[model samples]
Target chain A: MNDYLEIFNLKKVYPSAKGPQTIVQGFNLKLRKGEFVTVIGHSGCGKSTVLMMVAGLSTITDGGIVLAGKELDGPGPDRGIVFQSPSLLPWMTAKENVMLGIEQVFFTAEKEERELIAEYYLTVVGLADSMHKKPGELSQGMRQRVGIARAFALKPKMLLLDEPFGMLDSLTRYELQAVLLELWRKNKITAMMVTHDVDEALYLSDRIVCMTDGPEAGIGDILEVNFPRPRDRKAVMEHPDYYRLRAHLIEFLEVHAHKKKPASTVPAASPAVAVAA
Target chain B: MKETLRKLDFLLLPLLGAAVITGLWYFSSATWAGDLPNPTKTWTESKPYVLDPFGKRGEMDQGILRFTWLSLILVAKGYSIALILGTPIGFFLGLSKTFTKAFDPIIQILRPVSPLAWLPLGMVLFAKVKGVNISEMAALFTIALCSMWPTVLNTAVGVRAIPTDYMNVARVLKLSRWKTLTKVMIPATLPYMFTGFRLSLGIAWLVIVAAEMLTGRPGVGGFLWQQYNALVYEQIILCILTIGLVGFVLDRLMSVVERRFKTA
Candidate 1:
């Protein structure tokens, strides 16, 4: 596959009192044009850090990221991001919040055209009626929808999502995942999302890059998800290989991925022993 | 009927408090403070000013409302200047650590100095300028200088307190520095800035009274001083009441404006 986006040996080292603490090292990935990839790992595994580096929101201490044949530097409008929090400007209405980025990216466009662009994306995200409402007035799910719309409105060469639905309830998460997939299908934008949910990674990504536990986390394994395009939720769950992939992911997380304690460590006492004590 | 009674209680409670204060004042005037005029005597002697608020007998002897209006105009001028100057200083103070470090000590030191102290400096500075009302200029300068600290401090605090999430969004959008300020920083900091403005206006109103008295300008404070000199204690009380009422109204107006901007 053509390397539309390449992250080569990306590393992050934060200085601590003891010494330089390397959170992520030897991290590398490549994405083809219009491909959807998800980085899955436990909490604090530097998955988001890796995504942040790729988006150019965080400084890379070592290595490099090249997107669409251009070397990345500081953040630019070429890469769109959806943060875990909606991050909508509270003062602006949903349409105005979306219009903010649209104005920046499409500066040469007419004012009415920009307004229409904001309106159209907000409408597509199922916020047509509440397009004029501020983020404070909207539900958490609706606010995230606006965030998704804002990212897509930029029409960036790459889309980076840092645990975009990590804060939502399961139902809201499922609904937003559908909304995201629908938008991705239409735009065919090269997208990378960092998530902790196994089912979410399974449903949305073409490939899942799992990271080891942190304090120097690296790619532990990569699983290709070739469940075919235009995937229906029910069909994907019912596929013959679905249980196999699910068990494989669960096993990696439960058994192989966690930091092992030394054999000299003693196990805790039973409930009765604690009560007697 | 119950809701109406609750609404009535809101008005009634304050009225009761005022009546109690008035009763105590009357008792004190009738007993220990024989020189002090009773409320009834004060009302009777000040009736002409109350009845014809805008009446003008001479330049300095105008009706009480005219004096109050003059004070308000002075305060408005000074408050506008304060906001105009203080807001940008506040933005810089909040945005740049170096700027804050260099100037913050000076601002803190200057902020606590009274408006009365600033008056002589203002007079000396305005005395050299040509073709302007010197006393008015000095009064305006003193008022502006005294009132600007709150706006500057609150604005700096507000700008510094902006959410990290918003800044991150600015980064991802690749917003220009100008766009980041206008679209993100300004809007986010507006509520706090208005809080500063409201406080600044209150300070301006407060300083105007003292400034006017020292400047001997045609304002409520000047009228109060003039009444004291003329030995018309009732008129002094009248001027005091007028100043309090106008200050209350100005504060209410500012709070209304502050609420309108606190959309977030």
Candidate 2:
């Protein structure tokens, strides 16, 4: 297969009242077909900003994002993004929300076909019982499940998740991480997840991109998670590499945790040693 | 006992208050001999008028009931017009910031103006409409114009209050503009729009009666004025009671519609 998604020098600079603020710079990554990549960063490392740029929700001030070998334009069906919050439409039932994206993407599909697809995906995400309930009625974890179901229902080539399980309790987050892993495996869909949890990154990703602090933030290091498939959370944590990867990510975050860079470091990628020095 | 009392609370206060007011009116009519007749006499005289205004019962004219019906029709016409026109305008204003910015100031400026101020303009314009006499249309024109503001303002506020995340979902899902407006925006904004509708209905009912009085049209307000001149205190009291009852019913009807939409 092809490189499912390629980000070359992706950057974002937002105009704030104080001055120009750089949110993400020199954000570069490549997702091979069916590969799952998780980006773990401290708060304000621009992890979420990077996801938004890829999703086409936010503009990229410089560089380019290529998805399935085509330069990304505006929002399209090819990229499905689940936000930090579930962000499901409150007025629609959970099933309807999933069906909405499917109907739009697969416009020529008949009504029965659309319903079947929506039902299939909702069951996949473990929301089969919540198909008729509105977002408000669902628990925080359930709502995020609906969001996951909606995103996956579209069958996008690349799934973009911005802290999809961050709001949930520990147990629910674990469950959803497992649910996401299964869905990703079953479909062999490429996904790039932005999260703050180190263990979560190691649990779910093929490669974990550790991000440092920003005004000028980019990947600090990459850890290739070579854990075996159908990964058991209990077994995975016990694996020696899991703790090693977790420790490396924790150390990177602790040193750069919420540190504001001086003006000089706020530009595009300088050498790694430039910041480290 | 506490639960029973809570359930009874909805009906108890209003019914008891109505009875007390009726008792006071009965006593006042029994005591006062001047131009104002007792509540009983007013009711006795007005019963036939309400039931069969056109069918001649006595030599005394049924002009009062006729005027009351005219006012009711005028208010209905005006409020209906307001509902139809204001709802769509409010929906659009609420949905689009561009529309809100362009129209909000104009609505703000016009909304606060007294509906009474529109009376002379209504007379002047209706007089020029040719087929229908200006004098006949004045009450409705004034009522409709006065009632349009609340619906418009309420609708816009509701539209603006839609959660930003909801809008983002609409964008992400690529819902057609038509679908968004119908399935999402309208249903979400219904409560606010109904609030505006109820306010406008009450305002329109009040404004139409007064406008009818001023315009000399056949309605409750005009009938009350005419009855007051005749010095038949009982009939005057009857007309007043009739106007209040009609206005209350009209307000309740609007609220019922609002409630149905709420539950839906």
- The candidate scoring highest on lDDT is 1
After the best TM-score superposition of candidate 2, give how far the Cα of residue B241 lies from its true spot, in angstroms: 3.6
Give the proportion of true interface contacts each model preserves, from 0 to 1. 1.00, 0.37
Error of 1 at A109 (Å): 2.6
- Model 2, B1-264: lDDT tens digits are 989988998899899998898888777656774545666677787776667766543333555566666677777788898889998898888768898888888888887777678888888887768789776577667787789889988988899898666666677667788987876778788888898999998888888657866776666676666667676556676767777887798789889998987755
Among all windows of ten consecutive residues in candidate 2 chain A, which has the lowest summed lDDT?
A: A268-277
Could you tell me every candidate's TM-score relative to the true structure? Answer: 0.93, 0.86
Q: Which candidate is the best by TM-score?
A: 1
Q: Quality of candidate 2's docking, in CAPRI categories?
A: acceptable
Error of 2 at A23 (Å): 2.0
**What tens-digit string does per-residue lDDT give for candidate 1 at B135-184?**
99999899899999889998999999998789988988888899899998
lDDT of 2 at B228: 71
TM-score of chain A of 2: 0.91
DockQ of each: 0.67, 0.37
User: What stretches of model 2 exceed 4 Å from their correct place?
Assistant: A258-277, B1-34, B50-72, B95-98, B133-136, B249-264
Clashing residue pairs in candidate 2 are B29-B38, B67-B218, B67-B219
